[model samples]
Target chain A: MLTVNNLHASVDGKAILRGINLKVNPGEIHAIMGPNGSGKSTLANVLAGRDNYEVTSGEVVFQDQNLLEMEPEIRAREGVFLAFQYPVEIPGVSNLYLLKAAINSVKKHRGEEELDAMTFLKLIKEKAALVEMKQEFLYRSVNEGFSGGEKKRNEILQMALLEPHLSILDETDSGLDIDALKIVAHGVNTLRNESRSMLVVTHYQRLLDYIVPDYVHVLAHGKIIRSGDKSLALELEAKGYGWIEDHASAA
Target chain B: MAGLKIMQVQPDTMLASGTQFYLDQFEQISDKLPGQNVDWLQSSRNNNLARFGKNGFPTQKDEDWRYTPLKPVTGKAFNLKSAPTSGVEHEDTRSQSALRPIPGLNCHRLVFVDGFPEMSMSDIAGLDGKVSVRSLSEVLAEDPETIRDLLDSVVGESSHGFAALNGALHQDGLVVMLEEGAILSMPLEVVYASNQELTLVQPRNLICLGKGAKAQIIERTVSLSDSSCLHNSVTEVILNEGSELDYYLIQDQSRSSYQVCGVWARQKESSRFSCHTVTFGGGLVRNDLRSEMTGPGAHCDMLGVYSLSAKQHVDNHTTMIHGAAHCTSNELYKGVLDQRSRSVFHGRIKVEKDAQKTDARQSNNTLLLSRDAEIDTKPQLEIYADDVKCSHGATIGQLDETSMFYLRSRGIDPDVARSMLTYAFVNDVLGQIKIEPLRDYLEKALGEQLIREKKLFGQTK
Candidate 1:
């Protein structure tokens, strides 16, 4: 579903992602774990085509199309979603309004009929319920004065509505408490399907407990040095990243 | 033309050519002006005309007029002429289109063509007997003493040259007077349409509400002529004790038109006054809003929103005076400038020494959509009372980058994203409008403006 070969990226003339390569097939869930400053979020942003992150030399192909050449909105319309670590607080644009516009844009790009107001409302309600979001939150400004849990849930609600082909969850559990973690994890687990692919980026292994992944890769110094099954996350949780750093240096 | 009187121009006063031209026009029309036979009215006009001749148009040197330049208005020559005795017999489609009534707004409608009240087009019947609505000319001809003190009472000895010009040369306007305890269930809609080339239209409106009375007034100024014209209007309001008034002014003129408007209101004890000013058009425009709280427990709110594009320029100056104890005032003005358009907002709040327990808050915010677009915002607060609570703030910025990106990242087109954020920036003030139909109309108009501006600039970022 996605391919990243020798992805070399930088920000402000400083190298962040150096010689990184990864591949994910259909229906596969890959968890990228790394310590602080290991370029986990940077990789997610690069895939989403954030303007600040400059791709020095690399190639990113999504569904056999070059993703790096597309604009951010084009990438989004092409079924690429990035759940930001910090959801922006937009004071005037209502959550429901943004969701509707987003869905229609993607649908229009796919040559599908736009959803009517009634149908859009029904779909948004169902998605909000999946993330345990109240109906009132959808009418309010997007993430303005929202609690940490509500913002994370809003992101998931958007994800469920968009139903993107490649969903990159970047530190989705950073500010969420245990209960919120369960809710978000449950929403993701419910959305799992045979044709969907997800790249879960996290510094802690607690999020994986709820939404287990098919593969776990340890990213160190801008490169994935280790790949294993679910057991690898458990090992990293038990033994700190120090052991992995030492092992990578020895190897 | 048979009754024309040529008065001598004063040579002692040094005036700019623009000022001399207006002074000469006023001399020619003074004899035919309404209430010319009344001693007090004539004397007030003479005094204000003298003041205007001395100062000419306000220069940038004046403290209150620092951010606005008057060259565009002064450099052009506008003839001062009286309105035709009767309404236009032929229906001019341009002026007719400008006078189209707002849908779903049921109210007392009054239309003015080139500063003259159009009785044929007005609908003020079925009004409560206690409430009197008539044209200023009619009142002046019948009994000028009735409105002698109310006219120019709120704006006494005004410093603004435009206000003085309006005081001296105002041809015709609307006068609404309500008796004690009388309430107006429907809003009063006043539409002023300017449709003559190089003509000067000055309208003076007086609204007096007695004790315990309540009323809502909406004033709209529109331009129907393709040629450039000058529209100078002044509205004075007097609210008695416990009376409440809501006044809205919407200025949407032609791109080549020049407009200057001033609204001065005085509130008695326990009275409430609110004014909303929305400006969308005009080549050069200036709006001065002043409210004085004269009695205790009185409250005043001033809210304004302006959207300027192209080379259009707009200046909004507001003053809130807390003269009595226990009075509160709030002011909020926002603007969106795109392309080379410019906007200025100056808000001042004053709490007198005897006015204790006064609460006043003022804020001005502007959003610049292009590098060439500029805004000058200033919020001033003068609290003479030690126990008063007063705050003022101003902010000028571009479209927030993060907000723009967030919207675009969700598949919204960049143009749509920019427009959405721009609308959001001014939506707060728009939401405060209580009239649903008016607010809806403004929203649609402003939405179209945003889209049109986007197309004109084509991706400013």
Candidate 2:
């Protein structure tokens, strides 16, 4: 469902992602774990199409099309969603209005009839319940004055509404309490389907316990050095990223 | 006589001098004005002409005209085209051109061309037996009871030199009145056209709300002149006791045109007055808004917003005097300056000693998009009473970097993200605009200023 080949990216004069390759099929979840300065978040941002990072040499294919050729809004329309570590706070734009616009943008891309105000209200009510978000949160400006936990949960709620074919979670678990974690995890679980795919990027394995990735790859210096099953997360937890680095160098 | 009158009508101020030709060519039309109408009005114009003959034009030495000097305008005069400007029927705005009616506006509608009314550009279905619509000349011919006595009474007749000159030379404007306790269902919208070639129009409007009456008046002053023209306009409003009035001023003259606009509002006991000024065009624009709350429970809301680019200049000065106890006034003026453009905001709220329990608030917020662009903002509050609640605040800054970074991080290109954040900042003020269509157009226009650059922004993905 997602393929990134020879992804060499940089910012300013320094290189970040160097000669990277990754692929994930349907019903599969991939967790990219790395220590600080490991380009873990950079890979997520690159996939999300942030322009600040220059992709020097790479080709990203999503669903057999040139993903890099599409605009960010078009990528969203094509069922590509990114859950940010820090969501943007749009002061004058209401959360509900922004969500509705996002949904409508994707829907219009799919040639679907736009939802009316009444239908939108009903849809939001059900989704808000999934994330434990009150209706008042929707009425206020997007991400404005929201608590840290609320911001993370709101990101998940957007992911759920978008129902993207390939969703990237960039540290969505950071700053979240255990209950918020569970609620967000529950939302992810509910959204899991046979055709959907996810790339979960994190610095720790705690988030993996909830979403439970099918595969774990240890990324170091912008390249994945090791790959394994769920046990790799636990093993790394028991030890640390330093063991992986030392072991890779010794080999 | 034509050449001499043109020279005599030359503007004596910098703001006026830029378009002094409009006054110069408009010399012939002066005869059409000062009709043999009301004796009081005729004598008043004579008094104004004599007063103007003595003063000539105010200089920097004058107290009120200190910030603005007029020597440049008086140096030379251009011919003011006598014929009404033609071929300016449509505006060249990028957005959709549709006129929508505003419900709940209470008054009769009168449209104007240059300074005179052209019967072709008006919608008069809203006026029936309760109200009447006529040209300024027609008003002189058939004087109504209320309209005759109050024509130039509140305007700067003897005191204000330009106003006196306009009274002596004023051509046409709108006259509206409502019966006591009458509630108007539709607002009266007055459209003034500055379309004639090389035309200069000095327009004036007089509106009176009878006792216990409610009315709304909107002046949409637009000039499509690509050449240099001038539009100097003034309006005076009088609200009787227990009356309510809402006035809206939408100015979109040509970028080469210059305008000096002023409005004076006086409220009686329990009368409510609100004026919303939306200025988006003109080469140089200066507006003076003054209101007096003379009765308890009388309320006033003064709101303004100006968006300009290129060499456009917008200057606004507002004064709200609290004369009676338990009265309230609130003011908010926001501006966006781009390119080498400039904007000035000076607001003053005065609370008298006897005006206790007076609640007043004033705020001025401006955003400078370019380093070369400049805005001067000053919010003034004078409290003679210790028991009044008065507050004033002003802020000038660029867009928030954090918000811009956050948006860009969301996969939005940096430029697109910056534009979004800029829209959000101005929308914080636009959100208060009560009217939907005007708000919608202004919103699109303001946002267009950001992304409508000559070059393309960075492409995403």
Q: Rate the local accuracy (lDDT) of all candidates.
A: 0.89, 0.75
Q: Identify the runs in model 1 with alpha carbons over 4 angstroms from their true place.
A: B1-16, B36-39, B85-97, B119-121, B456-461
Best by DockQ: 1
Docking class of 2: acceptable
Question: B1-461, model 2: which lDDT tens digit per residue?
Answer: 65552322323423444224334433455555635556666676667666666666566686555555344333334233344556535555421132223333443456666676766557667454555545556677776444666776666543455565566666677767677887666767787766654455777777777899877667877764454456766687889999988788888777866777878888888998988888888877878898888888899999887877787888788989999999998898887777778888888889988999999999988877777788877777888988989888988888665565444333344565556666676675567665565567677766675667413322322
Clashes of 1: 0
* RMSD vs true structure, all candidates: 5.1, 6.0
Instruction: Return the TM-score for each candidate structure.
Output: 0.94, 0.81
- Compose the digit string of candidate 1's lDDT tens values, residues B1-461: 78985543234322358888889888788887788778988888988899898988888999888888887678777876664635453367766667888888888999887787777778999999889888898999899989987898899885589999888888788899999999988999999887777778898999999999999999999987666789999899999999999899999999888999998989999999999999998989999999999999999999998999999999999989999999998899999888899998888888899999999999989888878989988878888888999998988888887777777778888888887888888899999888899999898888888887778654633
RMSD (CA, Å), candidate 2 to true, equals 6.0
Residue by residue across A1-251, what tens digits does model 1's lDDT show? 99999999999989999988899998899999999999999999999888789999989999999999998899999998999999999998888889999999999999999999999999999999999999999999999999999999999999999999899999999999999999999999888999999999999999999989999999988889899999999999999899999999999
RMSD of 1: 5.1
Global fold similarity of model 2 (TM-score): 0.81
